[model samples]
Target: MTIQRLEVSNPEFTPNNTQMVTVHSSHLKRRHDINFYNVNASGQNLPVIILLHGVYGNSWVWMNLGGIDKAYEKVKAELNIPEFILAMPSDGGRLDGSAYLPSLNAGNYEKWIVEDVIDACKQTLDSVTHNSHFYISGLSMGGYGALRLGAKYPNLFNGISAHSAITKLADMAHFVETPLSEYQCEHSSEADVMYWLKKNHHQLPKIRFDCGQDDVLYESNLQFEKQLKDAQIPYLFEQFSGGHEWAYWHLHVQKTVKFFADIEQSL
Candidate 1:
């Protein structure tokens, strides 16, 4: 879990308070992108919120497109929340998307996010230490990654929030052009979100997800919510008025920041 090489850009070139990071990942055997934002470098032991992007998107979408950095700053100031380090990473650069799952054909994209990305953040950001609480979040395909990964690795995340998430692996068909067969793995449960949620039901952290009423995945999200209830898992699900677009994500991401802040306060 070592970063072979690290490159950071000047803040002048990037969006507000965001620094682009490229780490040569041993897991992916290639360099991956992570857009990082930390306003207070001197702050110690700050919580980290890792934001994952959807298909055809890289790390910059969270800030450059959604203005998540600005939203984070606003939320922190308005809610009086502690400073948080925002680390947004790409989805392994697979064709259209990797769905953030380990595949027999593709490399270990799941480990790349859960292991390499976190390691890169810890190595590059002084405020993100091993003791720092981590919250996972994303939109669309990345939302599936956040929820699945958070459920699968409950020990690694303190809170989970997703917006307009693809609730199941089959939902990837709507977003990706890649054949579904390429995502096949030995363990069937590895590709299923409900399996992980049920397997780790007792250990899961506070979970929350929302979807736009007009979003393509809205029905699937409702079905997934039903599955969560059937499994007796506690979670929060909200429906808003929008579609599956950046405008929706940009407007609602503040809720995610505040959600994480509330979790931090409780802990």
Candidate 2:
């Protein structure tokens, strides 16, 4: 799949920021549209990091917090890190509280990510470099999406980070049974997530997860972390002071990029 570049605008943010563009294969076939902001480093061969956004959020949210561009800047500044490409996709329609799951409305979120979006990035972006690998990370629902997608397609991503992730979708369902502003969590099932894990846990990517100490989803994050620990899954788990807002996630993005950078170096 070739990247069909586009120039778009988000007046809410910086008007001058060019909407650097591309498309994934699955999207191209179905005419499914996803946006990406790509940053090329100084080196000829470099690893790539794909960033996924959270529920009710799009590619633009990461840019607003300066997280996406910051990741590029930090890694490039470190110099020890290889040149990298950051592709943040607006998982269309899946953001309506869908948690990147294959919705009745959205089809298979995981497939779109691993097969379509990623394949396109790799092929179109020249992913197979001489000295680099692929990586991914996300926040909240996107965090869940990152883990789930990485787990589903282990070879595609070298490492992953899940910040402020709603660890257990089944658990969230209970809370949504009543009502919550951001999510209709009832639509997703924990059993489904577990099924995904059961089928793909062996192929799971090296993962990192963290949540705000004061966030309501902290418990669920802890629960999933426990599951990973119990299964001897290799992962980094942490808790920091903050809440469910962008402030925590924005800060977490740096740590996430650093974590991936470290993993890339080791390999």
- Top candidate (TM-score): 1
Tell me, by lDDT, which candidate is best: 1
TM-score against truth, every candidate: 0.96, 0.77
Off by over 4 Å in 2: 1-19, 22-35, 126-132, 171-191, 198-201
Model 2 TM: 0.77
Q: Candidate 1's residue-wise lDDT over 106-204, tens digit each?
A: 678999888888887788777778988999999999999999999999999999999999998889999877888888887878989989999999999
Shift in Å, residue 53, candidate 2: 1.0
RMSD of 2: 5.0
